[model samples]
Target: MSDWIDEIKSQLPAGRVLTDLADRSSYSFDASFGQYIPEAVVQAKDKEEVVHVLKVANRWKVPVYTRGQGTCLSGGPLPVHGGIVLDISQWPREIEVKADDLTVVVSPSVLTARIDEEAAKHGLMYPPDPSSAHVATIGGNLAENSGGPRGLKYGVTKDFVLGLEVVTPEGEVIRTGGGTIKNVTGIDMTKLLVGSEGTLGVITEATLKLVPKPPEVQTLMAVFDEVRLAGQAISKTLTSGVLPSKMEFMDKACIRAVESFYPSGLPTDAEAVVLVELDGHPEALEVEAKLVQDVMEDIGARETKIAQSKEEAQEMWHARKQVSPAIAQIKPTKVSEDATVPRSKIPEMIERLRGIKEKHNVEIVVFGHAGDGNLHPNVLCDQRDQEEMKRVEDAVEAIFEAAIELGGTLSGEHGIGTMKAPFMERELGKVGVSMLKRMKDAWDPNGIMNPGKIFPEEGQKLVLRDE
Candidate 1:
């Protein structure tokens, strides 16, 4: 391994290859759990550097885990197998907005939020707005196929992508899709690679599709004395011929957590609060906002507050975004899982989550884009206590079981990285697993691209021990 790593270092620029212990240690872990130090780290600033690094890795049959700004919550960038950490986050930032084409081309290192900001100047919008968009690089979002509140009406990252510039595991540069929005020339490799979790290839550049910005927007918040009623309000609004741009839910635990951290003036007494946003023509928004308000009131909402100004509306959404960081302050370790169920089964899922917290003696906070049934169930626990972590492990498994039992997936927006690999077979049968493996084998014949992710090894299990 050292001999091949030396060979890679010799070809790149002097500062590109990093082998010091301190540098290698920094590349060991990501936002997710578990840390395995790689033997080397290469900050590839361009596609040529990536090609050189991949060719050397393939020659040595060493795993190369590509990463961006390290904002992925699903362990997508963890170098568990220990080889090379290909960090492309330093690539030259580029976002060329083709206003006439209603499209944008960006480099892999550009932040996801910048795309939308650039589009907004042209009276256009990029639909996929992940919570981490402000800091997370677009490459990481592309790897995980991330979604956000807007996913309720618009689609996810995979839907807005039109083309990709990828480098195969064998160090071959290939183009999937093109600048055109409509392309059916061959198999849709762009979609295949977007959510493949970086096991298929390393994305160097991407061309994204954009839509016209909505003319008007309205915001409403419904305070629910019962959490079940909040879930009911989400489903009712979707079924009542009213499609909101964003519908978010936060439980009492999450509401108090945010208030304690940021003091957003949220109602700490309510069991849950649902924030809804409608975007369209001004006249249509006036009518739809009324319909959404009526639905929430009919479903037993205690109070419904409509924001009269844009600043107030932004404050509501900011509180919703603060749940993750605010809850992190409660414990030393936080296990965040996006176990999504059907919209109709959300109430049952919430009930099961509450029961699991009591059953395992763990503090779990719930919040997320409830309009799409994708809820974030975060189990807050200290990792130093081995016995408590054991209970937390069981609680996570039970939550996965509950989602699958409800005809939902183990992950809604997050990818099946190292955290959820062990449960792959439980959701997808043996045959389904095998078929996916065949595709992986075809692309990554050497199996050197992001090993130890998405596919479980022999007798693998979920263990959050700090050993």
Candidate 2:
């Protein structure tokens, strides 16, 4: 270990190799509750530094994990293998907006919201707005192919990423895609690496495509007597020929949690609430808002309120964002699952989640982007309680199984990190799992880039045997 550290330090700038236990501990885990201390942390400033570290790791046959801002919810950046963590936050910060091409080239460390703010100056917008957009780096967003509320109408991060400057496992720099709008020359390597979760390669820079900013925006909050009613209302709104920029749902458990935290006049007794936003022309927004109101009323909405101004819309959205932190106050730990189904199956999916909670005798606070049918059903519990933790794990497994059973997927935006790798084969059949393994082998033959993550090892024991 000393020899390897000395070699890395000799290759890079002074103080680049971090072996201090305190600093190493900080980079061990992400937002995930699961923790694993990395052996060392390297703060690389440029692609050359990253290449040096990778070459050192390759020589020592040690695992290497790359991390951005460490805000990953899916344990994607967790260094469970006790190796080296390549921190990319020190990478160059550059943003170049080309008005002629309607595109932007940015470094990996650039924040998603910062790009949005920059693009706003040019009357353009990068529409992939994940909930963590405020803190998540563009590199992390591309690695996970992140999607948010706007994904319902605008699409995900993959749709905007036109090119990427990446470093392969062998420390070779490669460029996939370009600034052009159309490219069919060869394999779409850009899309393949977008959601690879750092397994394929490390992203150093990205060229993102931007669209013109919308003119008008309106937000509406509709309270329903039943959770399914709000789901049905979402389908009705989509079928009404009015595309919503954002559509989200929060159950009564989530509503009360947020109301207690904020006291924003949320209905505590309502079974569910659908928060919808439409962005476009002012004349079209007014008509769409009215149509949404009528659709909510037709679907048995108890009360409906439309934001009269931008401030009002922001207030409504802020209330929705408070659900996660507010629920954390009720328990020590929260196991949030990003299970998604077809837009039309949102009602049934929510119903199955309720059934799992009852069967396992656990509390689940449900909320998420209903426009894309991506629901976050969180299981709240104290991790110290042995029995409760077991039940929580069981309930999570049941949720995934139920999701796959209902023609839904195991994850919508959150990648299959360590938490969901055990059931990868269940969702993807034997052949599909084998194909993924082949891809992993083809990308990183030594299995050094985030090992024991997205793919399950052969003959590996299940994490929860009882479940």
- The prediction achieving the highest TM-score against the true structure is 1
The global Cα lDDT (0 to 1) of model 2 is 0.89
What TM-score, to 2 decimals, does candidate 1 have? 0.98
lDDT of 2 by residue, 1-467 (tens): 57888888898876878888999988977876577898889988898888888777777877888999998878899997988999998887789999779999999999898898999999999999998999989999999999999999999999999999998887778999999999986999999999999988889999999999998899999999988788889999999999999999999999999999987788999999999999999998999899999999998999999999889899999999999889999998888889888888888988888899999999998999999989999999987787888888889989999889888888899888787888888889989989988987897777788887888766643342223
lDDT of 1 by residue, 14-91 (tens): 687888889999988888888889888999888888888899899889999998987778889999998999998889
**TM-score, per-candidate, Cα-based:** 0.98, 0.97
Q: Model 2 segments beyond 4 Å from truth?
A: 458-467
Clashing pairs in 1: none
lDDT of 1 at 123: 98
Model 2 Cα shift for residue 303 (angstroms): 1.5
